[model samples]
Target: MVSYYHFQRMNKALPDPGSWDEYFETFLAGNVVWGSWFDHVKGWWKKKDSHPILYLFYEDMRKDPKREIRKIMEFLGKNLKEEILDKIVYNTSFDVMKRNPMTNYINEIKMNHNLSPFLRKGVVGDWKNQFTEAQNKQFNEYHEKNMADTSLDTHFRGLS
Candidate 1:
């Protein structure tokens, strides 16, 4: 869901189209987003037991940073101190990451900060505000049809 919103936002500055509907149609028609991601994640998920693949959901991590970080550390076989974990949580928090010029990619591409700040609102459900009714309908239809067989948990079911 957030990925959809990210794409929609990216479409705003891209040379794809003027309107959201047209932009979405063009982007989806290109088949870059879903095709690449599905193939990559599906491959990783397929060899989960054989390889060290821990499926991490963004929503789950956002909801519980400490728990998620601990899970990640465990996956990597790293048992850091509690204070260090707390420090990691504070340093990697959305606000800190967004504020840190080193972490944010605003300077890497020489993007004008006045026109676009690298990191926008780091929150879930922002897609509901951006996606229009017709856009949602189209996206839902396309997603339902294409992702019916995959195990990718998109969590995208229209707006509400």
Candidate 2:
């Protein structure tokens, strides 16, 4: 949701993960690769739309977590008091998220991949260092056409 290296592998910046339908792509690769966003987002969105479930992306949280959290509370039909909201915000910041046990992926899976602890930098725009120009162009085209909304992408922070 909050796009990152999850779209790209360490070395391959322009990989086509696979196709969901005949039109869009998704990451069916053993390892993630650069710019396969259409596949990933579209796949998840299709699944989410089918289910009576909510899917929140990381970029939305990163941009205004309190707002997003309030949305969550509203969705759950709970009104968290302002004080509790403050506490949640303080505890859910990137610093806290990295260390928090509840959000750690290690507890959720029996992974064979050597993933870092839940705190893989937690900052945005890691792709600038990784993506070649051609790869970025391809990624952007796919993302723009499929996503059509730049609002959700957190990867472009203008570092370049």
Candidate 3:
């Protein structure tokens, strides 16, 4: 979904929608996708040991940031004050983060602000707004085929 929205925003970089199956194939088969998948799998497996990886989902963080931050603090073996935790949660909220130049990438790119916002609606369902029915179907088919028989807990639909 992230990739779909990204390509939709940079539509000029996308292949024509008439060849959406091919486009989805190429996009899903890219090194970035495979790399991310492998990394996620590695993290998932490693998160079971004493010195485990701290796995945090973006959706989980968005839904309950205070709880997520507490988890992070626990993972780091830190018992920060409640005030400090609240401050961290407030600072890291999407609205606050979006306004922060360091987090938002306001000056890093060369696009018109009106057309291309660095922080364009930090919500989950933006892909539904951009993806056509055909494109969505093709992407789902490709995704299911590629990810078949994997133990990876994607939790994507669950989040939605």
Candidate 4:
């Protein structure tokens, strides 16, 4: 069965009109969200023994970009000048990426009805503005019930 995500993707990417057109896709998250962090982490974890994969958390990256940079350097077995490492970390921050059209891809997605701003307030607690208490409870329940088998965790981590 095609996933709602994939279906949405296919519908948008197809150039021609509807009425059963053969084509590719475009996708969006229902709540302007990204793919579930826990599921992705767990999926990569499950494949770790048999395949090569690297899992990263945006929160972790935000908290300590230099450390994340070092990890990437070590993973790729590359050494770089200290200044370059600092530059890379600084350049990759939410603030930097949001301003750089190349990184954010805001213009292209802006024309998309389903897609909103590629980068919102990079600050963490933005969801609080949009979700009510009841919605949050449902959000937690959804994760707790469906993501039960996954070991990953999520914090409503936002921009500081």
For every candidate, C-alpha RMSD to the true structure in Å: 3.5, 7.4, 4.7, 8.0
Q: Which residue pairs clash in candidate 4?
A: 9-25, 9-26, 9-27, 10-25, 123-159, 124-158, 124-159
> Which pairs of residues have clashing backbones in candidate 3?
none
TM-score of 1: 0.77
All candidates' TM-scores? 0.77, 0.58, 0.69, 0.65
Candidate number of the best TM-score: 1
Show pairs that collide, candidate 2: 7-33, 8-33, 8-34, 9-33, 25-39, 26-39
Candidate 1 residue-wise lDDT, 1-160, digit = tens? 3444344344444332345555566555655444444455556767876987878776777788999999999999999999999999999888999989788766524444554456777786677777788778877887777567677786565665
Q: What would the TM-score be for candidate 2 when compared with the true structure?
A: 0.58
TM-score of candidate 4 against the unseen true structure = 0.65
Descending-lDDT candidate ranking = 1, 3, 4, 2
Predictions in order: lDDT: 0.68, 0.56, 0.64, 0.56
Q: Which regions of candidate 1 fall more than 4 Å away from where they truly are?
A: 1-18, 31-44, 47-50
The runs of at least 3 residues in candidate 4 whose Cα sits more than 4 Å from the true structure, single-residue gaps closed, are: 1-42, 106-115, 156-160
- lDDT (10s digit) by residue, model 4, range 1-160: 0122223443444342222112111111122123554455567777967986666766678788898889888888899999999899989998999889888664343234343344555655556565456555655665577668866565643222
Q: Where does model 3 exceed 4 Å of error?
A: 1-25, 31-51, 108-115, 158-160
Writing each residue's lDDT as its tens digit, candidate 3 over 23-122 gives 4555555534334453456555655666677777777888899999999999989999999999999999989998998887655244335545667677
